[model samples]
Target: MSTPRNVQQLFDLTGRVALVTGGSRGLGLQMAMALGEAGAKVVISSRKAADLEQAVMTLQDAGIDARWVAADASKPEDINRMVDETMERLGHIDILVNNAGATWGAAAEEYPLEAWDKVMNLNVRGYFLLSQAVAQRSMIPRKQGRIINVASIAGLGGNHPMMRTIAYNTSKGAVINFTRALACEWGHKGIRVNAIAPGFFPSKMTAGTLAAVGEEQMAAHAPLLRLGDDEDLKGATLLFASEAGKHITGQILAVDGGVSAVTGG
Candidate 1:
């Protein structure tokens, strides 16, 4: 057996390369900062070049080796191109954070099929395609990789009666299982798959929901009596991406400030 590493050593990501989708802002950018701060070279991707350029500048200001690629994670061709470009630039991928997602607000009965398809395509299908492409091209051959999927408390079960997002809930639920199934299949291939299910965090995606349900009301619902902040996800993101969590796989960790703990999400 090998000697156990120190905590700092276990969490260090020196010389690694991380690719984060939907990384222009919000949770995706949060996770990217965590990885880059830990010494990994990070490449962030999104559909908007201007947003990505701004994000990359912010990351660079923090002393992180970072770059950006503008590609829509929802499209297969985009996914392939992004992966190919990253591989060409970075040589190999050590971590993949599948954080790109979409949501639609409509009652189950009145939900449009187009909306459902859009959410599912970007949220579920995009993750699978990106994972497959990254693995087949880089991770598999190296026999080492870390995949962190961004799930949500919404995936645990139904949301508040006021929230009408059947497709979002469904896609996230699928993501949870996808993490488990992919972890099981890829374990022997040296890839660890895990997920982070966040509760209400103020972001571009949840801005509407936050406005609909007053932030204070949402905060009160959580046992912690507050919503997640910018730094909330850093610890978990580093854990899953670094050697600190080497033995951990196929787990759904809810970073919801105990909301999921009480609500059973």
Candidate 2:
């Protein structure tokens, strides 16, 4: 027999609380809005208080119950404070989105050591540390939680000759494996760890590169002949956050417009 349907199973998140790092703007804000639209109370955090305030207001104007906290993900103390404050205010955290990241662009031969460390510190070290804090504080005791890390397609394979981001690419690759490793260890604890590797999207991070290369050229390179849109992130994020993905873990779900499938396009 098939499963039965009830009001409780309608992808409703009536009392869930979500903490989204880097939610002040870009893809982080988009994911926060999606979670709020699904009925979860969202806490958005970033290094800039101004941006966080603006984003909180924007979410409120849209009828979502949202709050903001200013913290640098790259700083361990700040990350700890953010998680503690979220718990204090929200009472519990059911979902955590590690969307904070940094990227650097330089040729492999000439990549600055400082640039490499900065990227790795924020993208890799900060990500793991924040996730650890959340897990220990909430997920571990409850024996249930959802963690989503925002990686990139650069992590999947080497970039084309036209683009180069050695540090960013390497950091993302670490994130991908980290997701799998943590999932393996925590699966028995009812904690799900997964990653989203997005393709080209119009975000501040990609703006300079896209402008330099031109959209036409970028689109032509993608198999879908286009970049990712806002809506592309909504469904996947919801799936992992909601019961729809209750059995899935350690997955690297790509939101690319068919870019990862091409061998040589």
Top candidate (lDDT): 1
Each model's number of backbone clashes? Answer: 0, 0
lDDT (10s digit) by residue, model 2, range 15-125: 999999999999999999999999999999999999999999999998999999899999999999999999999888999999998888788999999999999999999
Candidate 2 accuracy as TM-score: 0.96
TM-score of each: 0.99, 0.96
Clashing pairs in 2: none
- Assess the local accuracy of residue 162 in candidate 1 as a C-alpha lDDT between 0 and 100: 83
lDDT of each: 0.96, 0.90
Estimate candidate 1's RMSD in Å: 0.7
Instruction: Give the Å shift of residue 209 in candidate 1.
Output: 1.0
lDDT of candidate 1 vs native? 0.96
